[model samples]
Target: MTPRTGGRKLCGADELVFYDITASFEERTIFTDILKKTAERVFIPLTVGGGINTLDDFARVLACGADITEDSADKRSLAGIFLSYQAPVEVPGVPLYSYLRTITQKRPELKMTARKFRARVGEIAEQLDMDSSFITRELNVGFSGGEKKKIEMLQLLLLQPKLAILDETDSGLDVDALSVVSRGIEAYRASCDGALLIITHNTRILERLSVDHTHVMVRGRLVAEGPGSLIDDIDAHGFEQFEVAAQAAGA
Candidate 1:
């Protein structure tokens, strides 16, 4: 595939790095069917990553039939999960009653009496068999790291993407949060036939989520790619092995 920047072909197919930075950030959730539709329109291999916090993210990308796996590992996992669900800011000078009336008109199903609201939240919580009070909370804002991860997992349950590239979903999470996130990923894997590319440095998270492939990056290059067991080898021996190989290649 040829990509022209200012009428110049900077690289050919073999040298090209098919990166999809925009798709990752702009499309917070990648839908598999949507991606498949997109893939039908394109011929070249696609590499995509952004805002991917769960297995569903991977499913969407893979459904597109992309070959290379790409991702950004610098994600604010907990904060992002909560902020994604925050209520919209009230317009200046608009009364709360006006806002409520507008929302009720637009979404009649959510128009609830005081008692109805409480009962509905209670019933939905009961149906899920989870804590009711937690369901009524304002949003995921100001939540702990663990709480944030749980929220992300909840979003994943709702999305169910095909091929996911989790860009640092394990970062900043405590042991329990890590376990919860891992279990959520495992659950997703169990329920679907999708692939996962977990980009993380934490082995704790890996303990629960099975890894089929592992790739190492150094100085913006994928220096090594191998099976899931490569993670254990790297943890035990560090990147020294790859570094030596690189030095030899340079020599």
Candidate 2:
């Protein structure tokens, strides 16, 4: 048994453990074997998440004795949740306009015709200072850092999700691109009045936006939390203090 497994054996039945098998999704045989092993050995309540995409997945996990199962991918679309990945995936064969249209039409409440949707997207693209022909190209294929972020922002505006989870949206962006993205985020919050869950190492992106809460996490543990002023503190002092505190507490 692994050292981690040995450690888990010392825990009481009330203790909770989490396992992520997102990478094992493609190899179901291995994934199921792991579930069976974890289920048979662990005595505590288990919350298994990741890589579960369907009803079959849910059934398989529960049948294997996993107490609870959750998958963000399963609920993201139906719940009107948008997540901007740190590195957005590229769709080589799909045109941007076509992809946007497909997702927009899927939401019946939007009640936008194809023509109107096209116009709306164009308007947003223009606002981002993008070329009119930009959306005609394949989605995220052969795009620069700025172009990719612009497309992500376009999706954010077009879909107008109830919650926008932006993961390091400012990564690799130059000053100009960063400025544009900050404006897009500002516009989204102002117009959509949507809840935002932004995860970023850089405080520059948060400058233009209104931050309600700031949380400092180190080594997967939340060490500090406060209001918007926390951002300014972090900007000036950096994360060294929080990291030191986390280390001191054996986080």
Candidate 3:
């Protein structure tokens, strides 16, 4: 499990580091001790994969101080979201339409312009049953928790990251609000071929999602993985079984 550090001397005291697991499963142990030592020293950006079949493997990887979490969603705004949908490869200091025209010559499938971008975002807002004006509001000012989540969904629709990691987006919503959020999520799913990683403690949101896989995390590690039906099972049986399984896995 020799780390391909890309020539970055990890032994040096640095505030940040990125570690990706690339080898087969049996070699994971070679990394555990190094990560534990490094974690005691600095923050590590980690990705663990390869031959990790069970949730227990996820738990062990994270347990080796590879766990990481983030909350950058609050800093992103609705206007910013819309702006991200604009063509990024466009020529600098040129009108969006001009850059769009240039892009169209190569990829004729794209029809982009500043006007159409706004129209599309507005159309999405309307589909989510939201006021178009709110997209330009001062972020989440004067909005309820549910509204904030709705705006996040709008961002998800427009920005469309390669992997959408929604961390408890359904936390404080009422039934109606939950339905709206669910609809927005379904819309986003339909709009792209991207991946979604929904992190949550409640199963209410699962009612509308076409979940491919479900994983339960204990502490900061995944402890179970199953089909969408696992959501119903968890709802009925709770995390007692998962908690025990996690303990056993760690032991």
Model 2 misplaced regions, further than 4 Å:
1-74
Candidate 1 lDDT over residue span 150-221, tens digit each: 655554443343445576777887676677777778776876565666767666678765678888876566
TM-score of each: 0.53, 0.72, 0.57
Ranking the candidates on lDDT from highest down gives: 2, 3, 1
The worst-scoring run of ten residues by lDDT in candidate 3 lies at: 78-87
C-alpha lDDT of all candidate models, in order? 0.53, 0.78, 0.61
Q: Evaluated with lDDT, which candidate comes out highest?
A: 2
- Deviation in Å, model 3, residue 63 alpha carbon: 26
- Against the true structure, whose TM-score is highest? 2
Off by over 4 Å in 1: 1-132, 247-251
Clashes of each: 9, 0, 0
Per-residue CA lDDT of model 3 for 1-251, tens digit only, reads 22326423456433344445444477653356666766565544544434344434444455565533431332222112122211112123543333323433332233466577678767778888887667455555566777767766776676654457777777777888789889978987888766778877888888888899988889998677889989999988999999998888889
| Candidate 1 root-mean-square deviation in Å | 11.2
Error of 2 at 133 (Å): 0.7
Instruction: Please give the range of 10 consecutive residues that has the lowest summed lDDT in model 1.
Output: 74-83
Candidate 2's residue-wise lDDT over 1-251, tens digit each? 22236425664456445456656456553276677787777756566656666645655665566655243563445445688977788899999988988888766666597789888998888878888788889999999988899999998988887778999999999999998899889889888957889999899998888899999898788899999999999998999999999898894
